[model samples]
Target: MPEVQRIVFAGTPDFAARPLQQLLDAGVRPVAVYTQPDRPAGRGRQASASPVKQTAVAAGLPVFQPPHFRDQTSLDELQALQPDLMIVVAYGLLLPTAVLTTPRLGCINVHASLLPRWRGAAPIQRALEAGDTESGVTLMQMDAGLDTGPMIAERRLPLPATMTGGELHDALAELGAQLLLETLPDIEQKLAAARPQPDTGVTYAHKLSKQEGQLDWQQSAQALANRVRAFNPWPVCWFEWQGKPVRVWSAQADSAEATRPGTVRRSDERLYIATGDGWLELLQVQPAGKKAMPVADWLRGSGQALQSGEVLT
Candidate 1:
C-alpha cells in the first residue's frame, strides 16, 4: 500500500476530534481541517468553535468552515487543496459528489454503528435505546446516500446490560480512534478489498428530539429503563410530578405486583414507579432547576412529600 499524502480531515464534535488527535500523534498531520461553522451554544448562546476546530487551531493547522458545499466557491476552495485522502467523521453536512471525488483516494467516513444497521443520525443513542447486544464503529468509503457506503474496516464492542448512552459513547469514541490508526497503515489494500453492505438488515436511526425523552409509564419497565439510559446526559427521561417535570438519570426494572402505570410507590426509603409490566426503581433523579441526586437524597430534601399512591402523571 502506498503512503497516504495530503490527508484532509473533516469533522465537528469531540467524537471526531479524538481520531484527529490520534492521527496527529501518529505523525500523520492533515494538510487542512474542515469543520462545521461555529454555532450558538450553551445557556449564553454564544457562537463557539467545534471541538475539531479547536484541536486544529491548537496544532496550528489551517481550518476551513463552510456553511455548505452548495456554492461553487466552497467546492473550488476544497479542490485547491488537492487532498490525497479525506477522513470525514460526524461532519454533520452532506458532501456533494464533487467534494467526494475531489480527493485522489476519495473520501472515507468514521460512523458510530455496525453499518447496514443504524445507518443515520443518532446511532449511539439509538443502539442503546434498542437494547442491541453490541454496537461498534465502521469506517466506510463515502457515497452520496446517507451512510450508505462500502465498508473498509470495522471494530466491535459488546454492550453491557447496564451501559448508559454516555458510557457507550465514550467507549466507541476511543475504539474508533484506535481503529482509524490501525487501518491507516493498510488503508489502500483495505479499500481495494472493501465489501458492499448487506441490504436485508438496513435500519435508520432517526435524530433524537427532546419530546422523545418524555417518559411513558404505560410502557414495560424494561423498555422505560432502556429509554432512560439512552436519553441521559441529553434530553433526560422525565415524567410529570407535582405539576413539574422530574428528570430520571438512572433506574432499573424490577418485578412487582401489578398497579396502575405512573403510580408512585415507596418501600422504606427506596422509590419505585409502577409501569405496564413491572416497577421501575428510580436510582437517581434531578428536580427542575436542581442538581441530580440519589432518590434517597431527593426524598430527604426539601420538596413536597411523595404520597404512597400519588400518581406521577
Candidate 2:
C-alpha cells in the first residue's frame, strides 16, 4: 500500500475526535481539520467548540468551519490544502462531487455502523432501540448518497441486552478509532477493491428529536424500556405527573397482571407503573427542574405522602 500524505480530516463530535486523536498518537498529522461551527450548549447556552475542533486546535493544526462547501469560495479553500485523502466521520454535511474528487485517494468515511444497516444520523441509538444483537463500524469510500458508499473494512461488537445508547456510543467511538489505526495501512488497497453495499437490510436511522422522549404508557413495557435506554442522557424518557414533567433516567420492566396503563403501583419503597402489557419500575428519575435521584430517595422525601392509585400521563 502507498503511504497517505497530506490528509484532510472532517468531523464534528466526540466520535470523530477520537479517531483524529488516535491518528495523532500514531504520528499521522492531517494537513487541515474541518469541523462544524461553534454552537450554544449547556444550561448557560454558551458557544462551545466541537470535539473535533478542540482536538485540531490542541494539536496546532489549521481548522475550517465552513457552514457548507457547495460555494466555489469554500471549495477553493479546501482545494488549497491539496489533500491526498479526506477522512470524514459525522461531519454533518454532504460533500459535493467537486470536494469528493479533490483528494488524490478520494474521501473515506468512518461510519458508525455496518453499512446497508443503520445508515444515517443516529445509528447507535437506533440499533439499541430495535434491540439489535450486534453493532459495528464501517470504513467506506464516500459517495453522494447517504452512507451509500463502497465499504473497505469493518469491525463488529456484540450488543448487550440492556446496553444504553450512551454506552454503545462510547464503546463504538473507541472501537472505530482502533479500527481506523489498523485499517490505515491497508486503506489504499482496500479502496481499490472496495465492496459495494448490499441493497437488502438497508435501514435509515432517523435523527432523534426531543419530542420522542415523551413516554406513551400505551406502548408495551419492553418497548418503552428499550426506548428509555435509547434516549438516555439526551431527551430522556419522560411522562407528565401532577401537571409537571418527570424524567425517567433508569427503569426495568416486569410481566404482571393487566391493569390500566400508567397507574402507579407501590410495593414497599419500589415505584412500579403499569404499562400496556407489564409494569415498568422506575429506578431513577428527575422531577422537572430538580436533580435526578433514586426512586427510593424521591419516594422517601418528596413523595412520602403519595399513595399508589395515581395515574402517570
Candidate 3:
C-alpha cells in the first residue's frame, strides 16, 4: 500500500461532513479543517456550531473557522499546513488562486449536482424546485469560477417524486463519500484525468432566499408539491392563514376544490387549497414556533377551520 497524503479539508454544512469523515476512515491524515464561522441560529438566536466543525472535533482534528480567506495571516496559516492535497466539499466560500495553488494536488470539490447544470450553491434545492427528474453528484477540481472546475469523477442518483431536500441531501452525502474514496487512489497515483465542462448546458443555481419559500396557492398542486419538497428543511414552503404564517411540510395534488386560489377548504381527515387547475392537500404543517403537526391536528388545535376567500401571501 502507498503512504497516505496530508490533506487539508474544507467544508461547512452536513452535506460536506460525510466525505470528510470518509477520508479520515480511509486512513488519510488531515492536517487541518476549514469551515465557516459560527453565527446566530434557531429560535433563541444563539451562536451555533457548523456541522463540519462538529464532525472535525469528533474526529479529533484541528479546526479553523475563518470569516473569509482573503487576509495575509489566514493564508500564511493555511500554507503552513504543507498539505499535499486539499479536499473541499460544500465549503460555501470562494477560494482565491493563491489558496487553490497552495496544495500540491490542488483543491478538489464535491459538488452535489452534475457539472454544467445547476453549477452553483443550492444545487439540490434548485433541481427539485425546477422539477428535475434526476440530479447527481460530481467531484471536480476547484477553480476561481463557481463550480467550473474540471471533473475527476461523477455518480448519479435518482430524484424520486417523494424525495424531500433533506432526504436527497442525506442520500447524496452518503453517495459522495463512496465516490471520494474510490477516486482517491487514482488521484494519488496521478492516473485520474479531468474533462472541462462545456460552454453549452450551463445553469447557475442561485442560493435559496426566504421569499422563494412562499407558496402561491394559484399554482397547480403539482408545482406546490415540488416547492414543499424542495424547501423542507430551510426556508420551508409556507403560506398565510388569516394573516398568520403556516409552514407546509408535505403536500399532494388533488382535484376537488371548487373555490378560488388560496381558498382553504376542508374535508374529513384532509385540508385542500384550490389552484388554477388542481387542488393541493396539505399533509403536515407548522404554525410559527409550534411543532409540525398533521393538518387535521392543526385545524382542530387552533379551534378554527380554514374558510374560503382567505388570501395567503
Candidate 4:
C-alpha cells in the first residue's frame, strides 16, 4: 500500500464544512472526502447535497457517500485510501471500530460542546435551553463510545444571556475551525497527552423534534424565553393565534404583573404576556405566511385590534 500520508475527512453540515475548508486552505488537503448522501429538502423535496459535500467538490477532492460502514466493502474501500488520519465533524453516522482503526493515526472529532456536557445531537440548543453561561468546542481523539473520548484541546466562548442558538452555532463553528488548524501541527503530541473527561457534569443533548416548537403559556416567563432562544432557525417556538401558528423569534422576561398566564400586558409601548411567573415581552414574531416583523410593526398591522388583557393561549 502507498505510504499513509493521506487525510480522510468525514462531515455533513455547514458546521462541519468550515473545518474542512480550513484544512484545504491551510494546504492540508484530504485525499478523500466522505459526506452523507443527498437528501430531499425544501418545498419541492428535491435531493440536495450537504454543505460539506459542496465544499469538497469545489476543492476538487474525491468524495464518498456510503450509506453505512456495516458492510465489509465499505471498510475495505476506506482502508484502501491508506489514510494517515481521519477527521470527523458532525458526520451524522456512528463509526464502527473497523473504520476507526483503518487510519494509521486513527480519527479525531471536532465536537461542538466542551465534552462530557452536551455529548449528543443538539448541543447548541441544549446549552441555550439550559441557560449555560459558557460554551466551547472540544477536539477529541475518537473512540468507539459516543463523544466519550480523550480531549486533545478545547476553546471556550462566553455565552451572552441574549445569544440565540443560531448565533452560538456560527460562533463555535468559526472557533472550531481556527482551533483545528492550530492543533493539526502538534496532533501527535496532543493525542499522547490527552486527558480523560470527568465522570461528573455529563449530559446528553437529545435531537430536537418539530413538536418541540409548540409553546406552552403556563411555563415560567424566563423558561419560555429560553426556549425561544434555543429553538430559533429550527422548530421555532410558537403559539396558535386565530387557528394559525405564530412563530416567536425573540422575547424577554420582565417583572410586570398580570391576572393570569398568557394574558397580554403592555407598558409604555411595549408588549408583554404573563406566564406562570412575571411576563414575557414579545420582541419579534412571524405569523404564518408572513415575514418576521417587530412586535410593534406586527401589532400596528395584523395586531391592530388585539388588545391587552387578551390571552394568547
Q: Largest lDDT belongs to which candidate?
A: 1
Error of 2 at 94 (Å): 1.5
**Most accurate candidate by TM-score:** 1
- Candidate 1 — which pairs collide? none
lDDT tens digits by residue: candidate 2, 54-149? 999999999999999879999999889988899998999988999999998999998888888999999998888888889999999998899998
How far residue 17's Cα lies from its native spot in candidate 1, in Å, is 0.6
List candidate 4 segments past 4 Å from native.
1-4, 267-269
Error of 4 at 196 (Å): 1.0
By TM-score: ranked, best first: 1, 2, 4, 3
- For 106-172, candidate 4 gives per-residue lDDT tens digits of 9999998988999999999999998899999999999999999899999999999999989999999
Worst 10 residues of 2 by lDDT: 298-307
Q: Candidate 2's C-alpha lDDT?
A: 0.90
Q: Would you list the C-alpha lDDT of every candidate in the order shown?
A: 0.91, 0.90, 0.85, 0.90
Give the TM-scores of the predictions, in the order they appear.
0.97, 0.96, 0.92, 0.96
Report per-prediction Cα RMSD to one decimal. Answer: 1.1, 1.3, 2.3, 1.9
Tell me the lDDT of candidate 3: 0.85
Per-residue lDDT for 258 in model 4?
A: 48
Ten-residue region with minimum lDDT total, candidate 1: 299-308
